[model samples]
Target: MRTRFTWGLTVNIMPPDYELRLKIVKNKIAGHEVSKLIAPEVLEYIANNCENDVRHLEGAINRLYAVTAMYSPKEINLEFAKDALKDYIGSSVYITNNIQKIQKAVAEYYDLTVESLKSKKRTAIINHARQVAIYLCKMTTEETLDKIGLEFNRDHATVIHACDKIGESLKKDEELREEINKIKDKIMN
Candidate 1:
C-alpha cells in the first residue's frame, strides 16, 4: 500500500441496477446491428438475469457477438437468448451447493472466514485460502469458470490463473499437497 504507483487510489463501482443494466445491454446491442437480430424480450432477459456485474453484461454481449456470427440465427428470441446465454445467466448453480461448501471448507482449514475467501483482501493468508477454494471449486464441481468467478467477485481468467497456480505448485510441493488433501476431505464430508 506504500509506493507502487504515484496514485494507487482504488474506486469501486457498484453494478448497475435493473433498468440501467437493461439499458446498458440494449445500448450495447444497438451499437452494432444486434438490435435487429435480437428480439426485445431477449434483450429484456439478458438485462433481467445477467446478475449484477457490468462485465457479465459485456461478456453476454460478446458471446452474442460470437453466436450470431457463428450460427447466423434468423432472430434472437427468448429461446435463442436462453440457449446462447445459458453459460451467462440463470440460477444454474446455487450458493448452498458446491461453491459455498468448498469455500467453507477451505476457510475453516485455513482459519479464515468464508467472507475473506470471497473478499478483495490479498493478504498472504487470505489469498492462499482463496486460491485453494478456486482450485477445489474447479476440481470438484461441474460449474463453469465464469460461474465460479461470480462467487468470488473475480473474472473467469482469474479463476483459471488460480487453478493453474495451485496445480503447478501441487506437483512440486509435498506440504501443499497435504494441505490441499486436508481441505478436500473437509469438503467431501
Candidate 2:
C-alpha cells in the first residue's frame, strides 16, 4: 500500500518503510548512531527530489539506511501514513482544480468570448476582465507569482500588485465585495 507525506510546500507519497527510515535517518542526523554517520544533507536531498511514487521513495530511504549502516530497521506502520498521504494528494488536487474552475468562471462571467484567458488584449473591458481573472486566480490558485504573471502576460510584481489592489478594495468597497461574492457563489454552485 502507499501513503503520503507533506513537508511544507511539497507533498509526496510515503511508503510503509518510510517511518523506519525516518527514525534511523533522524537518529543518524543527530549523530547518535555509533559506527554510522548519516549526514543530514542526504535526507534533505532525498526529500527535495523524491516527490512521486511511494515505492521509489522507499528505495531512496533504503539506500539512505544502507549508507548509514543501520541494519534491521523496524517496519513502518502503514495505516497512519496511508491516510496522511491520501489527504495530502486529495487536497492538492482539489485546490488545483478549484482554481482552474474559478479562472474559467471569471472569464465566462465577464462575457469576453476569448478562446484563452491568456491571449493578448488591451481594450478597457478586456483589461477589466483580465484584472478580475487575475484577482480570482490569485485568490484561488497555489501557483507562484511568476507563473501567474506569465499566465496574464505581465510581470510577477504586476500580479502581486493586482492581487493587493483587489484584496484591499474588496475589504472596504462593499459594492465591489458584493459583486465578487455573487460571482464566487455563482461559480461555486
Candidate 3:
C-alpha cells in the first residue's frame, strides 16, 4: 500500500472593511504622530478613498506625510487631501474603463478572440469586429486616439477611420446597430 497524504488549507485575503481600515489609518497616524500635523477628517478621507488595498492606503499616508512635510503646514485639511491625492483617486476610475475591457467585451460578443480583432486581417468579419471594438473604445474611455491605436497596433488615423466607418454603418444597418447596442450594454453594465 502506498502512503497517501492530502493537505487542505485555503486562505482568502480580502481588503480590510470600513472600521478595520479606519483602525489601520488611526494606528498609522498614532505611530507617526501625524495627528499633530493633519486633521482626523483628512486622515479619514485618505482611508476611505484608498480602500482598494492596504498597500495603497499606506502609500497614501506616506504621500500625505511627504506633502505636508514639504509645505510645513500647521494643519492638513480635506482640501489639502484632495489636492494631494487627486491623481491617485482619479486613476482608480480609469483602471476599470480601459481598452482591454472594451476588446474583451467585443470579442466575446462576436465569438472571436481579442487577438483576432487586433490582427491585420482584412476579412469582412474580422474587420467589422475590429471596427466595433474601436468604436466602443472611443465611446467608453477617455483614452486618446493614439492610445486606442496602440492597443490595436494601428495608427491614430486608422482608429479614427474605424470609428467613423462604424458610426456610418450603425446609421444604415439595423441588425448591426442592435448588435453593437447589446455589446455596449454588456460593457456598461
C-alpha TM-scores of all predictions:
0.49, 0.45, 0.49
Worst 10 residues of 1 by lDDT: 88-97
13-44: candidate 1 lDDT, tens digit per residue: 87675466767887887769767878765665
Question: What are the per-residue Cα lDDT tens digits for candidate 3 across 1-189?
Answer: 233323445577887754566678888888675677676556545654565688888888888888877887777876677677666664644224689988998899989999988898888888899998987676446567789999998998999799778756654687886787577667767
Stretches off by above 4 angstroms in model 1 are 1-97
Could you list the CA RMSD of all candidates, in the order they appear? 16.5, 16.0, 14.3
- State the weakest 10-residue window (summed lDDT) of model 2: 75-84
Quantify how close model 1 is to the true structure by its C-alpha RMSD in Å: 16.5
Query: How many residue pairs clash per model?
Result: 0, 1, 0
lDDT (Cα, tens digit) per residue for candidate 2, span 95-158 = 3434457667777777765345666767776766667667766544455567777767788787
RMSD of 2: 16.0
lDDT of 1: 0.74
